[model samples]
Structures are given as structure tokens and as C-alpha cells.
Target: MNDPDRARPETPPGHRGVQYAGRALCWSLAGGMTTAAVDIVLAPGFHAWPVLWPLPWYLTCVSAVAWAVLRAREKAAALRLAADEDLVQGQDWERAA
Candidate 1:
């Protein structure tokens, strides 16, 4: 999974924190606003079980955030690799044989 050769957008060195904050804000606003709207609409139907009304929508938002974080971490791991040691080893093996 930590393949350094993958193509991705290169973020500037010092702005990584800002970029992360922007992403978090976007996801938070989208999930919160959409879920709030849906909960309001469903409130009339599930008046008795108010807790269950927003459960599904909130769970979906959480799952989406989790998925995004998983992908970002995977990409970060790939980017952190200094070099592909295996490629050098493969070249050596080829030369020896």
C-alpha cells in the first residue's frame, strides 16, 4: 500500500495544516447541515422515538468520514516512504544473475 510511485496532488510544505483544516470544515458542514435537514423532516413521523430518527443519518456521516480518513492515511503512508528499496534490490539481483 505504501507505494511511492502513485500520482497525487503535491501540497505545499507549510500549508498542510491549513489544507487539512479546510477539508475537515467542509466535511463537518456538509454532514451536519444535511443530517439536520433530514432529521427535521423525519421528526414528525418518528415523534415517539426521536433518538432513532437521526441515528441512521449520523451513522452514515460518521462512516463517510471514517472512509475518508482511511484513504488519507493510506496516501500519507505512501508519501512518507523515502525511496523504493525493493527496486534497488531488484536491480542488484538482475545484475548479479
Candidate 2:
């Protein structure tokens, strides 16, 4: 059977503003921390990154980048959902974008 809730107009989450702000803060801080940790472990050759860095450092950096990338992907998915909701409810797309 079709779901009745599907036809209802969507409302923005009550905490949407704070939730997105928190996500942005966390994303930037985590990305910076990852790069900084790699710089610490790689010592003088961090500028060269995975190229000149030792195997362990390279692996760690790779993992950090992967984590950040995945977080970004999740953020994009969240934004997409918000945008979809906004479209359904006749809201402006600016915030969701």
C-alpha cells in the first residue's frame, strides 16, 4: 500500500541550522587535523606527501584522506536530501545548496 506520509509537505528539521553548522565545523577541523597529523609523522618531508613519506606515513595519510572524502560524500547526501525536501515544500534552495 502507498504511504500516506509521502504526500505531506516536508518541513525543515528544527535543528537544521545548528546541525549543518556543526557538520561544517567538524569537517574542516577533521580535514586540517588529518593533514597536520601526517605532517607530524612525516617530519621534514610532509610537503612531498605520500611520495617522499615513509610507507606507514603514506598509509596513514591515505586513510585520513579517505575518511575526509567519505565525510564529504555523506555531507553531500545530507544536502541533497535537504534540497529535495525544500523543493517539495516550495522553499528556497539557497540553504540546502
Candidate 3:
């Protein structure tokens, strides 16, 4: 039987990386907004200090998580490409034998 996945064209890693980056940015924005909302609700008055206090920490955490995810994706793509190359090489060897 023919495989469905083999018929489809593979997306470039850079395109996938862009998608992941966009998703990460969206999630980070949502988290920052939620944090701001909570700060606003809990604080007595509209104080810039309380609302803005978590900005640095939130940014740092988001950057770290995004970086890790992108790095992992890069590594996984590299491994997959290498595996594919190995398979092709093995098939060529088999044909030659």
C-alpha cells in the first residue's frame, strides 16, 4: 500500500519555525495580559508600579521558553533530515549489491 505522508510535500523548517515563533509570541502576549488583569483586580488603585512590576519577569520567562522550544525544533528537524539521508544511502547501497 502507498503511504499518504510520503505523497505530501514537506514544509521547510524555517516556515515551521516561523509558525512556532508566532504561536509563542501569542501565548506570551496572552500571559502578559492575564498577569496585568490579575494585578489590576487585586491592586487597590491604578498604580503603574504593581501592573508593570511583572513585565521583566514575564518577558524573561517567555523568552526562555520560546528559545528552548525553537532550539528543540531545530534539533529535531536536523535529526529527521539526517535519518532521511541515511535511509536514502542505505537504499542506494542495497541497489548496488
Candidate 4:
């Protein structure tokens, strides 16, 4: 009964924070986009649309930035994990010698 993950190192606290932040950002952006869509659809006419026009653009930019940040954090965590695994394996080899 070999559990593969037993030897893996735990993720850093900051990694979890990044994940949580990304989730929050995604949900908030989704809510904003949904609200914006409803507002645009139910508006009286084009005359009153200017106020709600920039919501999509703003949300898009923010979403892009958040996506990039999350991706970067994920990559960093993966690299760290790989390094830790290598270190652990090296120690095991040394002990076997």
C-alpha cells in the first residue's frame, strides 16, 4: 500500500494564499460580469448606457492580470516542489550509502 504523496513536501503558506486570492478574484469578476450583462440588457435605451459601458473592459483587464499572477504563482510552487523532491531524494540516497 504505497501512497505516492506521502513523501511530497507540503506547499508553502504563501502558495495557499495565492490560490485563495485567485479564487476570490475569479468569483468577484464573474459576479461583476454577470451584473454588467444584466444591466446592459435591461437598460432603458442607449441614452443611459454610457455609465455601464466600461465594466467589461475593466473586468477583462483585471481578470487578465489575476490570471497571469495565478499562473506565475503556480509555476513557482511547482518548481519549488520539484527542488524539494530532489533534495529529499538526495538525502535518501546519501543515507543508503
- TM-score per candidate: 0.36, 0.37, 0.49, 0.54
Local accuracy of candidate 4 as per-residue lDDT tens digits, 1-97: 2238676446653676567666766776776777678777776466756666656557656766876787787788888877877887888789779
Per TM-score, the best of the predicted structures is 4
Off by over 4 Å in 3: 1-12, 15-47
Best by lDDT: 4
Regarding TM-score, does 1 or 3 come out ahead? 3
Tens-digit lDDT track for model 3 on 18-67? Answer: 56665666767777777767767776465676657577557757766776
Ranking by TM-score: 4, 3, 2, 1
TM-score of decoy 2: 0.37
Query: After superposition, which runs of candidate 4 have C-alpha atoms over 4 Å from their true positions?
Result: 1-9, 44-49
lDDT of 1: 0.58
TM accuracy, model 3: 0.49
Error of 3 at 34 (Å): 24
Candidates ranked by lDDT: 4, 3, 1, 2
* Superposed Cα deviation of residue 81, candidate 4 (Å): 3.2
